[model samples]
Structure formats: C-alpha cells, structure tokens
Target chain A: MIDYDALLNTASTMGLRMLESGAEAYRVEDSLQRLCRAYGADSCEIFAIPSLLIVSLCDPEGHSHTRVRRLYRRGTNLWQVDQLNSLCRAVCQGTPPFPEVDGSLARLAEAKGYSPLLQLAGFAFVAAFFTLLFKGTAADALCSLVAGAVIFFAKYPMERHRANSFFVNGACSFLAALTAIAGVRLGVGQNLDKIIIGAFMGLVPGVAITNFMRDVLEGDLFAGITKLTESLLTATALALGAGIALSLLGGAA
Target chain B: MMEIFTGLLLPCFYAVMACVAFCLVLNHHGKLMVVSSLGGGVGWAACLLCAFTGSDIVQYFAGAVAVAAYAEVMARLMKAPATGFLVVGILPFVPGGGIYYTMEYCLSGDTELFLTTGIHTFGVAGAVAVGILLVSSITRLLREGRAPKNRHLGGEK
Candidate 1:
C-alpha cells in the first residue's frame, strides 16, 4: 500500500516542479489540487510564488502532510513546463501510481538543456538579428555577433558559479556594451546605440515581463506583483550595466 | 526608394530567428519552437505595420494583443500552455531598446532625452500589459463560459 505521506509528496512534487518551471501560481495550485484528488486525498492547498511554494494535504482522518520548498533560482524552461503540463493532464485523467509519477517528474527535472555551444550560437544569432531588426547596417550585425559571442561566454561562467541574477545580468550587459563600443571606436561598427540595443536583447527579461502580465491577468495578484518587481530589477541591472560602460567610454574619449 | 520588399520581409525573418534563439536560451525546444517562430514573425509583422504610423505605444499595444491572441488560440488548439509561445512571440517589441536608451541618456546626463525616453519606455511597457490583459480576460471568459456546457454534456463522468 502506498503511504499517504508518499502520495502527498508526489502531488506536492508535481506542484513544485510546475512552480519552478515558471508556471503561474494558479496553475500550480490547480495541479496540486487535481493530483491530490486523483490520488485520494480529501483536500489539498498550495501557495506558489516565484520564490517559495507551500503545499499541504489532508486525509479524511484529519491528519495532514505539508511540504515547503524554497526556489533559490527561477528561470523559464518551456520544455520542463510543457512536460509538467502533460503530466498534470495525465494525473487529472487517472490516478497514476506514485512511483510512476515520481519517475516522470525525475525525468523531467533531469532533461537536458541546450548545449553550451548551441546556446552561444543562439545568443550570437539573436544579437545579430536584433541589430538588423533595429535597422542597423550589415556591419553592425557583424559587430554585434562578435560581441554576443563574448557576452555568452562571459555569462556561462557566471551562471555555472550560480551567481546572483542582478550581478550576472549587470556584468553581461556591461561586457556586451563595452564590446560594442570598442568595435564602433575601431570603425568596425557604426552607431553605438544600435549595437547596444542589439546585444541588449538577451538580457532584457522578456520572459519575466511576459509572465508578470500573464500572472496578473490570471488574478494571481501576489505572484504578479513579485514578478513585476523582479522584472523591474532585471531591467535596472541591464540598464546599469550598459550605462556604466557607455559613461566610461564617454569619459575616456 | 521604398524597398518595400526588404522592409516587409526583413523584420519577419529577424523576428523568427530571434524567437527561435530566445527559445533555445529559455530551454524551449522541439516543434513548438517553430510554432513560436511563426507566432513571433506574425506579431512582429503587425508591430512593424503599426510602427510605420510613428506611434510607439500603439504598435506595442497592438503587437502584444496580436501575440497574446495568437498564443491563446494556439494554446487551445495545441493543448499547450500559452506561456510556451507567449514568452517568445512578443520578443520583437518588449521595450528592451527603450530601457537601454533610457539608461544611456540617464547616465550621459542628457536630462531632456532621459525623461522622454524613460516615460516612453514605461508607456510601452504599460501598453504591453494592457494588450495581454485584454486578450487574457477574453480567453478566461471563454473558458468559464464553456465549462458549464461541458458539464451539462456529461463529460465529467
């Protein structure tokens, strides 16, 4: 017989995964409720935000099991979110055994991210294309491609060390801005604004802003406010990074 | 020289490339990446069309609504969370440029440009929020309206 604690753990695990994978708070709550109901729990309650998730389950006997997880890191991984979405759908359809759901959740968490080389290439293309989209000349795109590669390489080490988001974003943007400025100074690119805007694409917190709006629209007011503040912080870090470099460049010239 | 063809096509191509790349960065892969690219392309095309009118806020609001509406429909058809597409679709006009320019002006001590850019940046950001909220409310209403019908149809069994 599967222990009640084990089943609650499984349900809460699913909720935690959804939360960490950037699902909205209400979605996480709904998934937890469904998973618990499918598995025979009388009641389930979940409070999920970007930073922390609280889940509790109650049996008919009035005994309850609760779990709290602190999400020290939060970022989008649509692949994980997609898989969890499928898992919850399955759970809602049938009460899969705890072990099966556990295996799936583990697999989802262990899913591989894009390779570093591919990520670098992706960053380069994103920066270059953003320059083109901004109406920069081909020369500007070429310059941004190189700067993007540098920023990607710099970002890898910081992320590897699990650095803070603000510091990582600030440093990455500074490196990108400085690289673009240096290139323009060398006559390799024209217009610092285009270059700065181009390389700034990746660090812009697009996902945060998008998720923030979605959360608010979904009536997850606390989650919305928290994510909005977080987005603002990220934008500030990005700007500070680029601004510092531009001012330094100005001073030196 | 209007160069209408290049002007029309370049942003779409760039939007597609940037969307795919940003998806990779966000760890979104598989066929949905292509869907995201298409969504991004169309949303960007809409924004670019509005941009010709020289109204930044309008384009952003319209672009965001277009993107969110697309994401909502696609999510229903694909049985996927709207986020997987919404996050990438509006990449072309997410105010990254405005934020950068605002900061640059601030740091360089250009008070006039800084204020203008800063206000414009916040305005565009609000426009995006407004657009998404508008579409999301509609989708929510649609879903809630359908729930009763599904229950009446005895699908709950």
Candidate 2:
C-alpha cells in the first residue's frame, strides 16, 4: 500500500521549501514534478499564482537565488523537464535564468526547429518598440529599452528562479518613471502624464484578477482569497513606487 | 472617445502581455493559453469599463468579480490548483490608487488622512476577501452536494 500521509507531508514540505526559497511560479511547477516522483506518481502539473509578494521580489537585486528541478519517468528512464523562467532586470544590469534548461527544453519541445536566441530577440524588439512609442523622453525610452534588453539577457535567471510577474512589470514601470523624472529634471519633455502612463504600462494585474475570479467561481475560496491578496499587493507596490516618486517631487514643488 | 480608447488600450495591452508572460512562466500552452488569455481579456475589459464609467467603487467590484469568476471557472475546468492562475490572472486589476494615496498621505505628515487612506486600503482588501469567500462557500456546498458515490472512495479501496 502507498503511504499517503508520507506523500502529503513531503508535498507540503516541498511547497513550503519553495515558498521560503523565493521560488516563483515556474520553480513551484518544477518542484511539483519532483514531489510527484518522490511519491512514484506518473505525472503532475503545478502552477503558482502571481502574488504581490512574488511580484515585489522581482527587483533585480532583492533576495537570493533559488532553483527547482523536475524529473519525469519514461519507462526505465528518468528524464529532465524544463520549467518556465521569469526574468527581471533593472535597466542594463542583471542576468537571465535557465540557459541550459531553456535550450534543452526548447530543443526537445521543438525537435527540428528550436531557436531560443531568435525568440528572445523578437521579444526584446517588441518591448523596445512599445517603450519608444509610449515614452515621451529619450531618457525614459532608453531606460525602457535597457530594461527590456536586460530582461532578454537575464531571461533564463528570471524564469529559473521564478521571479514574481507583478514585480518584474512593476520594476520596469518604476524604472521607466524614474528615467522620465530624471529627464524632466534635466530639461526634457514635461509631459508628466505621458511618462506616467508609459511607466504604468507594466503594472496591470489582469491575469491575477482573472484567476481570482475563476477560483471564486469554481468555489475554491481559499485559493480565491490568496489570489485576490496577491493581486491587491502587486497593485499596491506599483502605486507605492509611483506615489513615493510623486510625493517627493511634490515636496520639491 | 478615441482619447478614452487610447487611454485604455495601453493598459489593456499591458495586462494581456502580463498574462502571456505568466503563461510562459507556467509553461501553459495550448488550451491553457486560451483560457488564460480569455481571463486576461475579461479583466482588462472590466478595467476599461470601470474607467469609462468613472466610478472607483464600481471598477473595484467589477474587476474583483470578473477576475474571481475567470479564475474559478478555469480552476474547475483545468482541474489543477486554482491559486496559481488566480494569482497571476488578477495582476492588472488591483486598486493601486488607494494604496498610493494612503502612503502619500502618511509621508506628507497628514496623520489623519494617512490613517483614513490606510483604512480604506484595508477595506478594499477585505471586500475582495469577502467576495472570494462568498464564491468559495457556494462552490464548496455545490461540490459536496454533487459528490460522486463510489465504494473505492474511502480509506482503503
């Protein structure tokens, strides 16, 4: 007979470990695979909802790194599985996560047609286009571009450690705003609203809100509450950064 | 009208992008992607609707409800843990304004205003929590009432 209690305990422990180690959604997913193996389960899927705390951790130099790996059993062979990575970079600094796993997984997932560099370049370019379009000042645009580049470069790290989605977006927005503010101080465009709008582009919590509603409708109250809390917090973080900047600027006025 | 749409478009797109990012993070492609994208779309639409109506309370409630509904449905359909999806999907709809106001009031040395805003922030959070609880209780009752009967359901089949 299978030891259900032991399995449950192990799973719970793994979850707690991942949470404590600052593992984001992808890390949690990977951890779930490992947990399933420990219990001799054939297959498993895991998802960690974007929480405010998780989002806040997306600051480029906050907290330590955590790695989670998942193993899948195929007949007599145990194979490695690739988990999602979240990359959060500040301006031109920082590195991405999961280079090896990302490459391997892309190869396996797309056998004959895997091109990680191309995909990454495409994402970077798209992000840059949006940044330049919305940002009213060169400084703001440059900051956004740099942040996007950093995101591309550090994509593997961000994904591997499971940085918070909200945090990554919020940080990018904050940096953009900071750059715009600096531009204003340096006698650039005075379109505060445009800069504000541009900076806020990355701070929306659409996915979290949707998931919150879904969980509520599905009658999973605990999950719903947790998701709701997370959504609220990420929003708060964005607001906090903006509010602080505005307040300081106001004080000078 | 165009200005309003423009105002809404950037945020909506950003929200969608965030959702896609989350999907990538979770390695959810195929049907899961569709579900997540729909969830994101609904949430963004709610935000725009709230903005158009110019009602803060309405926006908050609408966003919360829409997101909660999206998450719950996906949770049931996917038969996976709902928390991950719920957390990620609702990222765009949080009440950032109230939080900013509260923090600003505090930093500006307006204790009364700060306290008031702080309380308001907590109230918003509480409201969201209550809504989640309400939905969850109803779901739990329905689940229990409709539980499948089986001999192998108990301790040792």
Chain A TM-scores for all candidates read: 0.95, 0.42
How much is the lDDT of residue A33 in candidate 1? Answer: 67
Residue A46 of model 2 has an lDDT of 42
Candidate 2 regions off by >4 Å?
A1-177, A183-253, B1-14, B22-30, B50-54, B105-120, B146-157
DockQ (C-alpha based) per candidate is: 0.50, 0.15
Model 1 spans > 4 angstroms off: A1-3, A251-253, B146-157
Which structure among the candidates has the greatest lDDT? 1
Residue pairs with backbone atoms closer than 3 Å in model 1 (clashes): none
In terms of DockQ, the best-performing candidate is: 1
Question: What value of lDDT does candidate 1 attain over all alpha carbons?
Answer: 0.83
True contacts kept of each: 0.75, 0.15
TM per candidate: 0.94, 0.50
What TM-score quantifies how close candidate 1 is to the native fold? 0.94
How many Å off is the CA of B13 in candidate 2?
4.3
